[model samples]
Target: MKEIKTKIIERIKSHFQDAVERDYDYNRLDFSVKKETIPSILFYLKDEMNFKHLSHITCVDWLEEKEFEVVFILWSYTDRLQVYVRTRIDRDHPVLDNIDMIWRQANTYERELKEMYGINFTGLEAPEEFLLEDWEGPPPMRRDFDTREYAARTYYTRPGREDAQDVRETIIKRTGEELPDFAKKYKR
Candidate 1:
Protein backbone atom coordinates (compact mmCIF):
# COMPACT_ATOMS: atom_id res chain seq x y z
CA MET A 1 0.00 0.00 0.00
CA LYS A 2 2.77 2.40 0.96
CA GLU A 3 4.72 1.58 -2.22
CA ILE A 4 1.71 2.30 -4.43
CA LYS A 5 1.08 5.56 -2.58
CA THR A 6 4.72 6.55 -2.91
CA LYS A 7 4.68 5.81 -6.65
CA ILE A 8 1.52 7.81 -7.18
CA ILE A 9 2.94 10.74 -5.23
CA GLU A 10 6.17 10.61 -7.22
CA ARG A 11 4.27 10.47 -10.49
CA ILE A 12 2.04 13.41 -9.57
CA LYS A 13 5.00 15.44 -8.33
CA SER A 14 6.92 14.79 -11.53
CA HIS A 15 3.97 15.63 -13.72
CA PHE A 16 2.18 18.46 -11.93
CA GLN A 17 5.27 19.92 -10.21
CA ASP A 18 4.46 22.43 -7.44
CA ALA A 19 0.80 22.62 -8.39
CA VAL A 20 -0.09 19.86 -5.87
CA GLU A 21 0.57 19.42 -2.15
CA ARG A 22 0.70 15.81 -1.06
CA ASP A 23 -0.01 14.22 2.31
CA TYR A 24 0.08 10.54 3.27
CA ASP A 25 -1.71 8.95 6.22
CA TYR A 26 -1.42 5.18 6.58
CA ASN A 27 -3.22 3.85 3.51
CA ARG A 28 -4.79 7.10 2.35
CA LEU A 29 -3.17 9.75 0.13
CA ASP A 30 -4.49 13.30 0.15
CA PHE A 31 -3.68 15.73 -2.60
CA SER A 32 -4.43 19.43 -2.43
CA VAL A 33 -4.50 20.85 -5.92
CA LYS A 34 -5.57 24.02 -7.66
CA LYS A 35 -9.19 24.17 -8.81
CA GLU A 36 -8.11 24.67 -12.41
CA THR A 37 -6.20 21.37 -12.47
CA ILE A 38 -8.78 19.24 -10.67
CA PRO A 39 -10.26 17.71 -13.77
CA SER A 40 -6.92 16.86 -15.31
CA ILE A 41 -5.57 15.35 -12.10
CA LEU A 42 -8.74 13.34 -11.56
CA PHE A 43 -8.66 12.15 -15.15
CA TYR A 44 -5.09 11.00 -14.71
CA LEU A 45 -5.97 9.17 -11.51
CA LYS A 46 -9.02 7.52 -12.98
CA ASP A 47 -7.70 6.62 -16.40
CA GLU A 48 -4.07 5.86 -15.70
CA MET A 49 -3.88 4.97 -12.04
CA ASN A 50 -7.10 2.90 -11.90
CA PHE A 51 -8.78 5.04 -9.27
CA LYS A 52 -12.12 4.29 -10.87
CA HIS A 53 -14.55 4.92 -8.04
CA LEU A 54 -15.70 8.38 -7.10
CA SER A 55 -16.62 7.81 -3.46
CA HIS A 56 -18.03 11.19 -2.52
CA ILE A 57 -17.72 14.95 -2.61
CA THR A 58 -17.78 17.10 0.53
CA CYS A 59 -17.31 20.77 1.40
CA VAL A 60 -15.90 22.49 4.46
CA ASP A 61 -16.55 26.17 5.10
CA TRP A 62 -13.51 27.87 6.58
CA LEU A 63 -15.26 31.03 7.73
CA GLU A 64 -12.21 32.57 9.38
CA GLU A 65 -10.06 31.98 6.32
CA LYS A 66 -12.84 33.12 3.98
CA GLU A 67 -12.37 29.99 1.87
CA PHE A 68 -14.20 26.77 1.14
CA GLU A 69 -12.43 23.44 1.01
CA VAL A 70 -13.91 21.02 -1.54
CA VAL A 71 -12.94 17.39 -1.22
CA PHE A 72 -13.22 14.61 -3.79
CA ILE A 73 -12.83 11.11 -2.41
CA LEU A 74 -11.68 8.44 -4.87
CA TRP A 75 -10.99 4.76 -4.49
CA SER A 76 -8.96 2.18 -6.42
CA TYR A 77 -10.29 -1.35 -6.25
CA THR A 78 -7.24 -2.90 -7.83
CA ASP A 79 -4.72 -1.15 -5.58
CA ARG A 80 -7.02 -1.07 -2.55
CA LEU A 81 -6.23 2.56 -1.82
CA GLN A 82 -8.19 5.69 -1.16
CA VAL A 83 -7.24 9.12 -2.37
CA TYR A 84 -8.60 12.47 -1.28
CA VAL A 85 -8.38 15.27 -3.80
CA ARG A 86 -8.96 18.62 -2.11
CA THR A 87 -9.05 22.23 -3.25
CA ARG A 88 -9.75 25.59 -1.67
CA ILE A 89 -11.82 28.30 -3.33
CA ASP A 90 -12.91 31.77 -2.31
CA ARG A 91 -15.99 31.44 -0.11
CA ASP A 92 -17.59 34.64 -1.47
CA HIS A 93 -17.42 33.35 -5.05
CA PRO A 94 -17.14 29.60 -4.77
CA VAL A 95 -16.92 28.35 -8.34
CA LEU A 96 -15.27 25.18 -9.59
CA ASP A 97 -14.81 23.30 -12.84
CA ASN A 98 -17.35 20.52 -13.23
CA ILE A 99 -16.03 16.94 -13.20
CA ASP A 100 -19.43 15.37 -13.83
CA MET A 101 -18.37 14.37 -17.31
CA ILE A 102 -15.52 12.27 -15.94
CA TRP A 103 -17.59 10.58 -13.25
CA ARG A 104 -21.33 10.31 -13.80
CA GLN A 105 -22.17 10.10 -10.08
CA ALA A 106 -20.27 13.34 -9.47
CA ASN A 107 -23.26 15.34 -10.71
CA THR A 108 -25.37 14.34 -7.71
CA TYR A 109 -22.55 15.18 -5.28
CA GLU A 110 -21.90 18.46 -7.07
CA ARG A 111 -25.57 19.32 -6.95
CA GLU A 112 -25.67 18.68 -3.20
CA LEU A 113 -22.56 20.81 -2.73
CA LYS A 114 -24.20 23.58 -4.76
CA GLU A 115 -27.36 23.47 -2.70
CA MET A 116 -25.66 23.10 0.69
CA TYR A 117 -22.53 25.26 0.24
CA GLY A 118 -23.56 27.70 -2.48
CA ILE A 119 -20.82 26.37 -4.74
CA ASN A 120 -21.36 26.86 -8.44
CA PHE A 121 -20.04 24.21 -10.79
CA THR A 122 -19.28 25.85 -14.09
CA GLY A 123 -20.48 23.92 -17.15
CA LEU A 124 -22.46 21.43 -15.09
CA GLU A 125 -26.20 21.13 -15.63
CA ALA A 126 -28.09 22.66 -12.73
CA PRO A 127 -30.42 20.22 -11.02
CA GLU A 128 -33.46 21.02 -8.89
CA GLU A 129 -33.00 21.43 -5.13
CA PHE A 130 -31.29 18.29 -3.80
CA LEU A 131 -32.22 18.38 -0.09
CA LEU A 132 -33.53 21.90 0.52
CA GLU A 133 -37.00 23.07 -0.45
CA ASP A 134 -37.75 26.75 -0.94
CA TRP A 135 -34.77 27.63 1.20
CA GLU A 136 -34.20 31.34 1.72
CA GLY A 137 -31.15 33.22 3.00
CA PRO A 138 -27.59 31.89 2.94
CA PRO A 139 -26.68 28.21 2.48
CA PRO A 140 -27.41 26.27 5.66
CA MET A 141 -24.13 24.34 5.73
CA ARG A 142 -21.95 27.42 5.94
CA ARG A 143 -20.15 28.08 9.20
CA ASP A 144 -21.65 31.55 9.41
CA PHE A 145 -25.20 30.16 9.27
CA ASP A 146 -26.90 30.56 12.61
CA THR A 147 -29.26 27.57 12.58
CA ARG A 148 -30.55 28.23 16.10
CA GLU A 149 -31.40 31.81 15.24
CA TYR A 150 -32.99 30.78 11.97
CA ALA A 151 -35.14 28.12 13.62
CA ALA A 152 -36.14 30.49 16.39
CA ARG A 153 -37.22 33.13 13.88
CA THR A 154 -38.75 30.80 11.29
CA TYR A 155 -40.48 28.21 13.46
CA TYR A 156 -42.67 28.36 16.56
CA THR A 157 -41.59 26.46 19.65
CA ARG A 158 -44.17 24.79 21.88
CA PRO A 159 -44.46 25.86 25.50
CA GLY A 160 -42.57 23.77 28.01
CA ARG A 161 -44.49 21.05 29.88
CA GLU A 162 -45.96 21.99 33.25
CA ASP A 163 -43.99 19.19 34.90
CA ALA A 164 -40.70 20.30 33.38
CA GLN A 165 -38.08 21.42 35.89
CA ASP A 166 -34.39 22.14 35.78
CA VAL A 167 -32.75 18.71 36.09
CA ARG A 168 -29.84 20.14 38.07
CA GLU A 169 -32.14 21.68 40.69
CA THR A 170 -34.25 18.52 40.92
CA ILE A 171 -31.21 16.29 41.37
CA ILE A 172 -29.73 18.56 44.05
CA LYS A 173 -33.04 18.78 45.94
CA ARG A 174 -33.77 15.02 45.86
CA THR A 175 -30.32 13.51 46.55
CA GLY A 176 -28.29 16.52 47.69
CA GLU A 177 -26.09 15.81 44.67
CA GLU A 178 -25.43 18.52 42.13
CA LEU A 179 -25.70 17.50 38.50
CA PRO A 180 -22.51 17.45 36.46
CA ASP A 181 -21.91 20.13 33.82
CA PHE A 182 -22.99 17.80 31.01
CA ALA A 183 -26.24 16.85 32.75
CA LYS A 184 -27.15 20.43 33.73
CA LYS A 185 -28.50 21.31 30.28
CA TYR A 186 -31.46 18.93 30.34
CA LYS A 187 -34.89 19.56 31.89
CA ARG A 188 -36.71 16.89 33.83
Candidate 2:
Protein backbone atom coordinates (compact mmCIF):
# COMPACT_ATOMS: atom_id res chain seq x y z
CA MET A 1 0.00 0.00 0.00
CA LYS A 2 2.78 2.41 0.97
CA GLU A 3 4.73 1.64 -2.23
CA ILE A 4 1.67 2.16 -4.46
CA LYS A 5 0.81 5.37 -2.63
CA THR A 6 4.36 6.65 -3.06
CA LYS A 7 4.35 5.75 -6.77
CA ILE A 8 0.99 7.44 -7.36
CA ILE A 9 2.11 10.56 -5.52
CA GLU A 10 5.36 10.72 -7.46
CA ARG A 11 3.63 10.16 -10.81
CA ILE A 12 0.93 12.77 -10.14
CA LYS A 13 3.48 15.31 -8.89
CA SER A 14 5.66 14.74 -11.94
CA HIS A 15 2.79 14.93 -14.43
CA PHE A 16 0.72 17.63 -12.78
CA GLN A 17 2.95 20.02 -10.89
CA ASP A 18 -0.02 21.77 -9.28
CA ALA A 19 -1.45 18.60 -7.69
CA VAL A 20 -1.08 18.45 -3.89
CA GLU A 21 -1.34 14.97 -2.39
CA ARG A 22 -2.28 14.20 1.20
CA ASP A 23 -2.96 11.02 3.19
CA TYR A 24 -5.80 11.78 5.53
CA ASP A 25 -7.28 8.27 6.09
CA TYR A 26 -6.29 4.60 5.92
CA ASN A 27 -6.05 3.33 2.30
CA ARG A 28 -7.38 6.69 1.08
CA LEU A 29 -5.61 9.65 -0.49
CA ASP A 30 -6.68 13.12 -1.57
CA PHE A 31 -5.25 15.02 -4.50
CA SER A 32 -6.16 18.67 -4.66
CA VAL A 33 -5.59 20.22 -8.03
CA LYS A 34 -6.54 23.23 -10.09
CA LYS A 35 -9.99 23.06 -11.60
CA GLU A 36 -8.59 23.24 -15.13
CA THR A 37 -6.52 20.10 -14.64
CA ILE A 38 -9.47 17.99 -13.45
CA PRO A 39 -10.20 16.25 -16.75
CA SER A 40 -6.59 15.41 -17.50
CA ILE A 41 -5.87 14.08 -14.02
CA LEU A 42 -9.01 11.97 -13.93
CA PHE A 43 -8.23 10.57 -17.37
CA TYR A 44 -4.67 9.81 -16.35
CA LEU A 45 -5.76 8.09 -13.15
CA LYS A 46 -8.36 6.00 -14.93
CA ASP A 47 -6.27 5.08 -17.94
CA GLU A 48 -2.73 4.89 -16.58
CA MET A 49 -2.92 4.41 -12.81
CA ASN A 50 -5.63 1.67 -12.66
CA PHE A 51 -8.11 3.79 -10.69
CA LYS A 52 -10.88 2.57 -12.96
CA HIS A 53 -13.92 3.01 -10.79
CA LEU A 54 -15.67 6.33 -10.44
CA SER A 55 -17.47 5.84 -7.18
CA HIS A 56 -19.00 9.23 -6.54
CA ILE A 57 -18.88 12.89 -7.35
CA THR A 58 -20.00 15.49 -4.84
CA CYS A 59 -19.90 19.20 -4.22
CA VAL A 60 -19.47 21.45 -1.16
CA ASP A 61 -20.57 25.06 -1.21
CA TRP A 62 -18.15 27.31 0.66
CA LEU A 63 -20.39 30.33 1.01
CA GLU A 64 -17.94 32.37 3.07
CA GLU A 65 -15.03 31.65 0.77
CA LYS A 66 -17.19 32.29 -2.32
CA GLU A 67 -16.18 28.96 -3.84
CA PHE A 68 -17.48 25.46 -4.44
CA GLU A 69 -15.35 22.40 -3.80
CA VAL A 70 -15.96 19.55 -6.26
CA VAL A 71 -14.75 16.11 -5.28
CA PHE A 72 -14.50 13.08 -7.54
CA ILE A 73 -14.08 9.84 -5.64
CA LEU A 74 -12.34 7.00 -7.47
CA TRP A 75 -11.68 3.43 -6.49
CA SER A 76 -9.18 0.75 -7.54
CA TYR A 77 -10.57 -2.78 -7.09
CA THR A 78 -7.21 -4.42 -7.70
CA ASP A 79 -5.25 -2.19 -5.28
CA ARG A 80 -8.07 -1.65 -2.74
CA LEU A 81 -7.33 2.05 -2.78
CA GLN A 82 -9.55 5.11 -2.77
CA VAL A 83 -8.62 8.46 -4.20
CA TYR A 84 -10.44 11.77 -3.99
CA VAL A 85 -9.73 14.30 -6.70
CA ARG A 86 -10.73 17.68 -5.33
CA THR A 87 -10.90 21.12 -6.89
CA ARG A 88 -12.43 24.44 -6.01
CA ILE A 89 -14.17 26.79 -8.44
CA ASP A 90 -15.32 30.35 -8.09
CA ARG A 91 -18.84 30.48 -6.69
CA ASP A 92 -19.90 33.47 -8.73
CA HIS A 93 -19.14 31.65 -11.98
CA PRO A 94 -19.02 27.98 -11.18
CA VAL A 95 -18.20 26.49 -14.55
CA LEU A 96 -16.29 23.28 -15.08
CA ASP A 97 -15.40 20.99 -17.95
CA ASN A 98 -17.76 18.07 -18.40
CA ILE A 99 -15.94 14.76 -17.82
CA ASP A 100 -18.83 12.51 -18.86
CA MET A 101 -16.68 11.35 -21.74
CA ILE A 102 -14.34 9.63 -19.28
CA TRP A 103 -17.13 7.88 -17.41
CA ARG A 104 -20.69 7.61 -18.71
CA GLN A 105 -22.11 7.64 -15.17
CA ALA A 106 -20.49 11.02 -14.70
CA ASN A 107 -23.28 12.51 -16.82
CA THR A 108 -25.80 11.81 -14.06
CA TYR A 109 -23.62 13.36 -11.37
CA GLU A 110 -22.78 16.34 -13.57
CA ARG A 111 -26.42 16.93 -14.40
CA GLU A 112 -27.33 16.83 -10.69
CA LEU A 113 -24.55 19.27 -9.82
CA LYS A 114 -25.58 21.56 -12.66
CA GLU A 115 -29.16 21.70 -11.44
CA MET A 116 -28.50 21.63 -7.67
CA TYR A 117 -25.38 23.82 -7.41
CA GLY A 118 -25.84 26.01 -10.50
CA ILE A 119 -22.46 24.77 -11.71
CA ASN A 120 -22.30 24.86 -15.47
CA PHE A 121 -20.73 21.84 -17.12
CA THR A 122 -19.66 22.91 -20.56
CA GLY A 123 -20.45 20.42 -23.36
CA LEU A 124 -22.49 18.17 -21.09
CA GLU A 125 -25.33 16.60 -23.07
CA ALA A 126 -28.19 15.79 -20.71
CA PRO A 127 -31.69 16.88 -19.83
CA GLU A 128 -31.92 20.36 -18.31
CA GLU A 129 -33.92 19.00 -15.39
CA PHE A 130 -32.14 16.14 -13.63
CA LEU A 131 -33.74 15.69 -10.19
CA LEU A 132 -35.91 18.73 -9.68
CA GLU A 133 -39.20 18.85 -11.62
CA ASP A 134 -40.84 22.04 -12.86
CA TRP A 135 -38.65 24.10 -10.52
CA GLU A 136 -37.92 27.77 -10.94
CA GLY A 137 -35.80 28.75 -7.98
CA PRO A 138 -32.20 29.13 -6.93
CA PRO A 139 -30.23 25.90 -6.58
CA PRO A 140 -31.75 24.26 -3.49
CA MET A 141 -28.52 22.48 -2.48
CA ARG A 142 -26.42 25.62 -2.23
CA ARG A 143 -25.40 26.70 1.26
CA ASP A 144 -26.89 30.16 0.85
CA PHE A 145 -30.32 28.69 0.01
CA ASP A 146 -32.69 29.20 2.96
CA THR A 147 -34.75 26.02 3.18
CA ARG A 148 -36.92 27.16 6.10
CA GLU A 149 -37.78 30.39 4.37
CA TYR A 150 -38.45 28.64 1.11
CA ALA A 151 -40.73 26.13 2.84
CA ALA A 152 -42.59 28.92 4.59
CA ARG A 153 -43.20 30.74 1.31
CA THR A 154 -43.89 27.75 -0.93
CA TYR A 155 -45.93 25.46 1.36
CA TYR A 156 -49.23 26.09 3.10
CA THR A 157 -51.30 24.29 5.67
CA ARG A 158 -54.70 22.78 4.88
CA PRO A 159 -57.67 24.12 6.84
CA GLY A 160 -58.34 20.70 8.45
CA ARG A 161 -54.66 19.95 9.10
CA GLU A 162 -53.51 23.40 10.19
CA ASP A 163 -51.90 22.35 13.43
CA ALA A 164 -48.39 20.91 13.31
CA GLN A 165 -47.89 17.56 15.09
CA ASP A 166 -44.89 16.78 17.27
CA VAL A 167 -43.52 13.35 16.33
CA ARG A 168 -41.85 12.73 19.70
CA GLU A 169 -45.06 13.47 21.63
CA THR A 170 -47.07 11.35 19.24
CA ILE A 171 -44.63 8.46 19.64
CA ILE A 172 -44.74 8.77 23.44
CA LYS A 173 -48.53 8.74 23.37
CA ARG A 174 -48.69 5.60 21.21
CA THR A 175 -45.87 3.60 22.85
CA GLY A 176 -46.10 4.88 26.47
CA GLU A 177 -42.35 5.29 26.38
CA GLU A 178 -40.65 8.20 28.13
CA LEU A 179 -37.67 9.71 26.40
CA PRO A 180 -34.40 10.16 28.29
CA ASP A 181 -33.66 13.53 29.83
CA PHE A 182 -31.00 14.28 27.23
CA ALA A 183 -33.30 13.26 24.35
CA LYS A 184 -36.16 15.41 25.69
CA LYS A 185 -34.35 18.51 24.48
CA TYR A 186 -35.05 17.36 20.92
CA LYS A 187 -38.85 17.46 21.48
CA ARG A 188 -40.72 19.86 19.25
Query: Any residue pairs clashing in model 2, and if so which?
Result: none
TM-score of each: 0.84, 0.84
Candidate 2, residues 30-125, lDDT tens digits: the string is: 999999999999999999999999999999999999999999999999889999999999999999999999999999999999989999999989
How many pairs of residues collide in each model?
Answer: 0, 0
Tens-place lDDT digits, model 1, residues 81-130: 88998999999999999999999999999989998899999998975777
Span of 10 residues, lowest total lDDT, candidate 2: 157-166
lDDT for model 2 comes to 0.92
